[model samples]
Target: MASSASSHGSINAADHSPPPPPTASAPVQAVENNLLTPVALSSVSLHGAKNTRRSLLDHVFKPLVRESASADTTFGDVLARLSIANQKLARYDIFKEDSIRVFISEALEQPQPGLHLDCTNLDVSISVKEKSRLVLSAGTDFGNAEGSAYTNAVIRNILGGAETLSVNASTGTRTRSAYNAVFSTPVNGNPDLRLGLEGLRSSTQKPWASHEEQLTGGNLRLAYLADNGDSHALAYSGVWRQLTNLAATSSPTVRADAGDSLKSSIAHTFTRDRRDRAGNPMLSQNGWLLRTVSELAGWGPLRGDVAFCKSEVEVSGAVPVLNSIRGGLPSGISVGGGLRMGVLYPLPTGYSLTGPAQPSRINDRFQLGGPTDVRGFKQCGLGPHDGTDAVGGDVYAAGSVNMLLPLPRAGPESPLRIQLFTNGGRLVALKNKGKAGEGGPTAALDSRAVVNGISSAVCELADGLPSLAAGVGLVYAHPVARFELNFSLPLVQRRGEEARKGLQVGVGINFL
Candidate 1:
């Protein structure tokens, strides 16, 4: 052993104790999960806002910043604030999809020394990519009753602050020609409120009524969204309508109403949608929907040739149907029901409520029955008819109940399904004693007659089950709309209502 020790050096531990664990000039801080840790927002900056206005950004971020300035605010809370701002920007339709991103880091510079020195301060940077300023497209539109090919031009963020200008032109089978221009902007830089001005011209053929309606008009509207996801809209509209180009087989009711009329009106609409999925019948297996509209025409400052008070309400609900035997129904089946009702009451024109009550006109009346409404009936078919034409009605009530089943071997993600449905409705016209009295300074309204007409109509609606239809169909939920092909039969119908016997194809965004 003495000889080996003489030949080699012996190993030993360092005497410096790992150099005092590598001490720093300042106190070391532990890295933490910033998301859960409390922190202070020292500053926030927005990037990629070339087309946006500074004032609009201030309006959106001022409140959020004030909230985040509290000492207890966590980094998670700051992220939530950023998320909300991102949503608003996306909703403005001025940003590219998924183009918003956030970056967080330690502040390069700290605020002046303060009592809250224990709080860690962080900086936030939000980056967003704007969409193209101009967009043009040509496409086709399939509405509830009409289909058309259209060309659209949109100017996004035209004047900054998410303002938009849109122009559209279209021609179609039912709509002979149409053109419209609209300018819309956020009110006071609040995305939840919008103000819009629109001008439109259209010539639409109503073959169901054996007439064509030409319209030249414009409207100013203010739309608001509440915190609970309800929407409200108020609009003032002035329109000039001409009923012309009558078919050879036009009905006397249609012929009598063929002329030019002016309508100056104010309207309010309220809507609430609480569906699990919007516009997807198979996926909307829970919750309810409601919409109401009220309008007044030719009253007070709004003076025109047509005078009436109109109200409409629609409600629908869906519930999931479960099967206990198999744990649940395959693909989550559902049952849904809907009801719609409308009324048009005559009102005196001018400032004098004593004037003779004007009758509801054809242009202002309601027409029920269609694939999107009541199945097995022709478009505008469940209403008053004269000769071969559907003259429409002043009051109508429609309802439908449907059950949807998943296709064999199809999964819940599939949009195709089988549907069994039953629907019924009735439309009635108010009996008018005579036309409006001419220049009625001395003429007075016959309140008794109006009351009687309304009462009779209501009594008739309550007298029996409405004209009924039953059907089975295949439903396809398209991304843009819903497609349905049904084999329907009219279980019961009125004398003049037109019922489609065998197969009917329907396409639109809304359905009963």
Candidate 2:
């Protein structure tokens, strides 16, 4: 992925959900009071490991069920209420409502491909590489944070090696052909949920060609949800990944951009918090939890988690943060379900998520969107790492959280909407640099170099940071199409005082 184009053109990276419903107030307040869910839900994928539900609450309602064994919820009472809610559903099922009928059939399967398109303005644009990434996870199980569905490929220049075989593997196979070529995989994805491994093969003739990159890897993500009635829950997944980019060969750039990761996720309706849906798709409420995770062994200094996400939010659009850790895991679990928002905004004492409404117009300014979680410090600000700064990583990993909410007293013509958001993070710098003969992990970046990198990165963020961003504008929404525009004036600055900072507009997508 490249730097996002105009935020209002098509769909920029990072996805989003619906506007804040009145019901979201509870979760937002709970977060402020330190009672809402944590950040254990970002990694969960619906198609890499198991069957898919349509929403987050597909499995978040059951009792803790932990006889001290497998439980992540803190409020046991939520379980009791959950059961009551289920019992209340029998009547609806008897009434033959579509949603109720679907709920009764645990035999219900997952959904199919759902492709979309939206280009509201020049600032945002989004497109999909494929039509649908359906997961048929039936007789299988992935993790709780990641998932996969299709097939993909990646190639790396050994920085030098083109004459030697230089191939290694664990459970799968690897093959190299003429003119610098390599093929490896586990192919389609997880067998249970999908057809086969979701992977590919590659070849390159250039040596120091294009940064002489290494550590090549790829993953095909699959997502599915029950689209039978309404309030669909996510389900099943298929995943397969391979890492061979870190071949001993050196490269133009020290580190490789390939964040090789593969995982599958699944979510099912265990019960509901408000079961009396009355056949109203929007009003129907159920508790669910979707989980997916992927772990792949590697070939060199560039080894570790390739990709991971642990997040949870309300179907209504409020995000939950995971705070603690337990049961052999390093982080806590997200406890509820919700819509996926595109932006995380900071509030006075708390934070809020932001996203535009679907079938809406897109703006050209105040754009915000990109590859996200990697490279360029702007929007795509994250990369491969398990709490470690392989290259100028953040000590606390100061991640920026943005959210969407209704703007107060804004006119109908306003292109932007007010969203409560916050961004607080520590500075990051390189602790060590790679050596000359060595690549990525081999170089030794002394304190001087690390200090310099840190200062420069911080300065860049400071110069680009949008202070107290809260306003309204034309927003775009779609399964793929995405766009948003907002005005934010920074309140705290390290040096000067200039209120001339203009509005923020961003857009992104998987295809465009």
Candidate 3:
């Protein structure tokens, strides 16, 4: 009978016909006879893993193959097992690349004298090229919120455990200065589970909002990855926040929430990402992302300065358009758009909106504006403003639509593009804490009076409607960030609202 077998340089497999049933006529063969039987892992050799511990590799590889004393494994089964092990090793991220080779080998011990040849065993050899363990990087970044120079030092394969440690620092005009250190490691020897700790300090000046904030915090995070390309993370953070340098023109509401406060909360984030690349998505790709953050303060040993629940959902997709029209437009031209909506509601913690002193904090409020947000408006330019400062709002909604056009020489992989976009959004303060004094009149503590007061506040907030803007821009989607120069005009505006007209330049990791 004729048989065929295929093998690759990186992986190997062989097919063998079972020896003719022990012919009684032939001389009794040795127990070491070579016959077609399931293969057993005899030994494993690792190359180029100098800094990695042998035990670590064993932990990652040992469970991958079952050790069956009975020889009943086939060559194909060995290949499949090696493939799975290779994937697990790649997830460590310590290696530039890795390959596994499998081959048949003789068992170490002597065989009984009743068989023909040496017993066959499977041997797995893993070869990996370690990536640089340490790296130092520095660069300058520009964006609508700030322009800054940043530097970072990173160490991989920390303590030979495939862990990572990094320290970063940055200084800029709007962000002032910031520093952070982070350490991450696999959890309980599971590559798919991770634990991280972070320490951070930063100071930021918001010129559009006329306030400077100083923050010092530490966080602990745990993350898990599922087989379906989904990830979940849970974190606990405690920080001391100080808001100062409030301009004299700042609103009374802003001044009330200004001061040092403690924010201790727990948050969870789930993400399902299927995009081809995260940095700059392809024009013909389709993907959606949903993030919901629920935060609770004063849960344990921390101060309950603020409490709120915020959730946001965004979906984006791209499709080929005008492709059938030969001469009408370029071949790669496509239309891409996304929808985003978010809501923020303050949780009651005995903090009365109508009290002499409210517990709600200003830094916790939501602010929307800038070229990355609602374009055609200055930074924090949308929503309600206190004098010239944007105080932000308790509730806000924003949506945008955009068209992406390929540049003259742009290819599917090229990041250059021309884009046209229109954005609209609204921000509103749900209850007027400024009217706390008004509840002291006829029915001071009466429920009827409280009901009327909330009605009045809602009525006052109705003055600010949704604002709309449209613009055209040059977008360069780089692997690390996106750059844009746009010219925008507001189609609708509110009196006293500051709108950014004409050319506006922005640089950041995301575009709204």
Candidate 4:
């Protein structure tokens, strides 16, 4: 009985001996150790920084560490938090490239064990290389209006505060010359809130109207980003505008409003973009944009020479279609559409208190047509005309529908496609003849006579129906720009309006 008991005790002792050392993989053991051990962040240091204030870095990274574990945090948790902090620093645009390197100061010679375990108190060091702070560049750009050359100098990270200052000058065929200076900064050190100020002097010629306009102005802007990735901006601008060099063929309305004018206005814009890319649209991408603007000029105590209120709204969107045929050509197709409408009304007090109330100025009226508007007509061709020049209208409406299809033999990823489209629009002038208190031709001419004369003039070239056009085009969409050549034919037209029957070339960011 004693021998049996001794054998049993030996067996129990053998059972109690340490099982063989774990043969599990290194990663498994590391994970186990990370789950078991507690670690604390001892210190953090930044290296290779010049011109950047250390306080700014502290402001950016300190918040990330505020919630870090005081006692129960594991090594893995500390490493993860450090990695996240590094990513946050990269978003400042101060770095050149993969600009962050994190390491333990004491474990430089043995990184593997430091990464897995063995370090209870961690001292993390971050190294970053700064990007170039000053840049000077000159380039040429072409648009639907004409070609232009520009030069600009930019200073970044100004005063170690990540602000921007820029000076630019540009000249084009139609736009004679322009100079601008701009300064921008983050508001209250919050990257999402931006404030900017800009001053500019510009002169432009309108060949279609046979006139030139000179403008000098300055504006202040504030922009903020919401949590849903939408952006909103508010701006105030004060400008002096003068129309000169009017040819003998200039429209009467143009001549009336051709003299110098002062305009002070405030505007706001909101944009919500959810597309996969801003420069190019993909079949899978879906997004929409809406913009509304209201401007008051020469109204109230600070009223200027001109008095009018203009309100405009525009909306555009793109959406994927025919998704069931994933392997066919329909997979690459999308539908896009947009609508634009605007109205201009006169401010009564500004003119009533001053001299004779003038009509809304030609410069502020709504003009429609051309490649950017209704594609089958010349620029401003859909509206009222004074001789050969478009006098524009007080109200305008335009809309378009397009089906974007991939061209045959083109790869699925190609940016080239065929666009089948139909667009239409109309513009009408608001007549002000018989409203009470408004001055009309004196009682010299009978009211019937005046009305008949006005009716005859309007009926001579009136557009009873909205201009309609249908066509197809080849669209080459680049990351930064888009170009198209459309073959459009007008289905409906006005009596005296000029319309383009054949191919029309367009260049801009989008069809709408």
Candidate 5:
């Protein structure tokens, strides 16, 4: 029998074919392989930066060009250098977001006399659109426990070298009226370093202490970022503070410190933040943070009405309990904890013969409890109390532990989460054994007495269980701030501490 096939080719019954491997384009392949073809940078040109100084551009790009223009330089090296330059420009905040464009082409001529013939000469061009010179904004804002209406104006590249001038004014329930002006510029055209001068005037209400304070001040500040991504700031401030508007029920402690005081102070602040989500600093699914502040007032040559040394430290960390299995969302639980501590030590501006030194002032002391700090307690509630007023403290310690669970349908990326938290703290006011009679105040405290008081306060804070609270809350992480609503109760509390029961609402940028 002869089997004849049709016009079409015969198909095999068991034939199988697999899809072809993906083919990437030249640029994609180059990036994947980190293209190392020998190249040299011949020239670089910048376009569209009208307000930015040419010297600033030169300062930023000179080192990059020098590094990438070598005969042995590769295409990858040039691209990396270009990226670094772009980042520097972006950090200056002079350009619009994502408005920078880079173009690269083979150079028509090789300028180097002894250049290698085998290496390709390339030209790089960058175009950037500067942001608007002036920005004005007005809005209503909510802070820790109060709301305010504010106006802000900013002038970018004010003096052509990525300098900025900002003016702000606000009126609020707690902050009656405030005005601030700041002028800042990069040091030596370095984005990592900046210098600023600021002037501020404000009248603020402190109902927690039953007093209002008015301040007029100016400061000179230098800020820089370290190689390890830490940020640091050094500043000197000259402030005139007048404490007034005391409530009828204001405690004697508040009344005693209510007066005009001049503070000539120097301060240092250090911060390190490593969190998974940069967009919302309030809710971190992972990573750790640390911030420390130190201030010296009226010591040695620095002269001021008040004299003290103040230090504060805050540390927090978060860890994931599970990995995400969903696409485009985080579907895991996280646990976080935070600790904050502060101390204010009294210092004598000058030597005295007979009387003791003054104690830490209300403004210079540490205030411990608030929605942004130890929760479930009223604002400044964990501190030493005089009648109905929380007098703050000379030394304090606070901490919190929280478990965050993603909302059932919202997912972890939603910026909304369910939080279970416990918070506790202690605030102690230093006592002076050498008090002058029953009514009059001493000039200053003895050095030995101040030291002993601080030690005793620290020991008391560390000795026993702190005033504590526990609660469950709904957390919303807005770009500008964090908001929370919770029904909470105090689990452990000291006498005179104000504890909140039932539902409470909180709004702030930072939380314990």
Candidate 6:
């Protein structure tokens, strides 16, 4: 895909630094004076413009999704009813500006909405070389809330693995327009340690403060690794970012491909308390962890994370022995607390680290699925408590999957990717097997989401299998240009309905 996230800002023409530190969390190739200086459009941009893609609003989108004027349906009915006879996917254009339109649905085209954006651009310009290996990406994001901006880049796949570096950048106001190359050479043919830089420069748009705000800052990152073809791998990264009118957000986790063994994991993020790079505010918090398996099998590919969360946050972080299984429980639970901030993907205002608000889409992650996380009942989650007396920590380990078959060929730029998938997860407290349906003893955690206080109670009282939903949508291929139309879909329906009304569709970049 030729970079699609609206290129608004100008690029910086100067080469500010040598290649970034071998391991910077997220490094911004220092901007000269951090100034908003306008310059002539880059020659590369005119080349891009000449080759610009046709608008998605034209032929392709119209034929893909359209309006069916029904004799029996009102605008509301037409909005509520899809062709499947009473089964409606979503409402349309609840609000519309001259160039923008919207849709609302409970479920996405199909499939589960994982953590990362599915694809960066509607045009699929990136592909693995061999199709045998899955490329894992690690790096940092930079931005400035004081200005408006956009950026785009590509990842080259070697042997089906993402192993090359490519990029494009621009600010909203044409203040900067330059591309910085880092880690140009594929590191040991390993996609895990791939170097990628994502940043933003946004200026406040007036009259949006009530609904949206402005934020400007820069975020950058570098990641690389050496893949030995068999089991061993080495990877690292670092990021440095500042926000002018910014909002805080949750922590991020680096992921591994499915079925691949040979374990390795080490990643975390840091933030300053202030809005800009200058140190007017205190340091908020930081996160880090490392885990390597002596033996890959049965180790289950160990994973860990530490984060500086919001003040409403109860706790965060874990101790070393926490991963050590002693009598079936970790030695200790992670602990820390204070007013954590908010950082949402594809933020609402160019200034804040905001994501789509509550009524729309939710892409922020709190904790993994388990006892303390989503507080409910599922597979085999029952065990004893090991948390501190005051901390109130409980344990529940679980796993689940969701699948879907596309009515269409799954391709890179096809705006509509649909399929069906089911998901499941469970966590058990080695000591206490809480009854199903009853939830737990406490009113807060002890609700209907729990087991009836016994085994078999899990399936007996429930209406059907342990299934909820999986949502999907489009994400501009580039990482820095936050133009994500995050979406989702629901599986089961409500009473008197053969299908489900549980579906929810909003605009946010939360799908994995």
Backbone clashes for every candidate come to 0, 149, 13, 0, 5, 116
lDDT of 3 at 441: 18
Clashing pairs in model 4?
A: none
* Weakest 10 consecutive residues of candidate 5 by summed lDDT: 6-15
Residue 281 accuracy (lDDT) in model 2: 23
Highest lDDT, which number?
5
Candidate 1 displacement at residue 27 in angstroms: 23
lDDT of 2 by residue, 1-512 (tens): 12212221111122232111222224545435642221111011111111122221122221211110122322233224334433432221111222221111010122111211210000111111211222122221111111112222222111111111122221111122211223221112111121112232332211211211122333433332222322323333333333234434424232333323333333232222333223222211223322222221221222232211122222222232332333433121122223221211111111111211111000000112122111112332222121222222322223333443323454322333333333332222233333333233233333355445445644554455432222233343332333445444444332211222345544433111
Ranked by TM-score from best down, the candidates are: 5, 1, 3, 4, 2, 6
Candidate 4 regions off by >4 Å? 1-41, 69-91, 100-124, 142-146, 278-285, 327-330, 348-358, 433-464
lDDT of 5 by residue, 148-218 (tens): 99999999998889999999999998899999999999999998999999999999999998989999999
Give me the candidate number with maximum TM-score: 5
lDDT of each: 0.79, 0.25, 0.65, 0.67, 0.80, 0.23
| Cα TM-score per model | 0.89, 0.29, 0.79, 0.78, 0.90, 0.23
RMSD (CA, Å), candidate 1 to true, equals 12.8
lDDT of 1: 0.79
| Model 6 lDDT per residue over 48-67, tens place | 11111223111222221222
Q: Let me know the TM-score candidate 6 reaches against the reference structure.
A: 0.23
* Residue-by-residue lDDT tens digits, candidate 1, 12-110: 112122211212222223333556677766655666677777667766666666676677877678778878877787878888859876666666675
TM-score of 2: 0.29
The segments of candidate 5 whose C-alpha lies over 4 angstroms from its true place after superposition are: 1-26, 30-34, 110-118, 324-329, 350-356, 433-443
Model 4, 1-512: lDDT tens digits are 00111110100102112222323335667666665566544445566656675555655556544434344566676667777666556656666657666555332233221132434554555667777888999997666646678999988888776678899999997899989999987776566678999999999888777789899999999988886888888888899999899997776556766778888877787777666564354332357777777776776654676666778888888787777767544366788888988777655434343333345666677778887668888867787776787867767778998888878989546788898888988776656432222212211223343344335434433346678888998888766556778998998887667788899887655456
| Candidate 1 ranges beyond 4 A from true positions | 1-38, 112-116, 278-283, 323-330, 432-445
Please state the error at residue 183 of candidate 6 in Å: 4.0
Superposed model 3: Cα runs more than 4 Å off:
1-38, 67-74, 98-120, 141-144, 278-285, 299-302, 323-330, 350-359, 409-413, 434-465
RMSD of 3: 9.4
Task: Give candidate 2 misplaced runs (Cα > 4 Å).
Answer: 1-195, 201-296, 299-377, 380-420, 426-441, 444-474, 479-481, 490-501, 508-512
Q: Which prediction has more favorable TM-score, 3 or 6?
A: 3
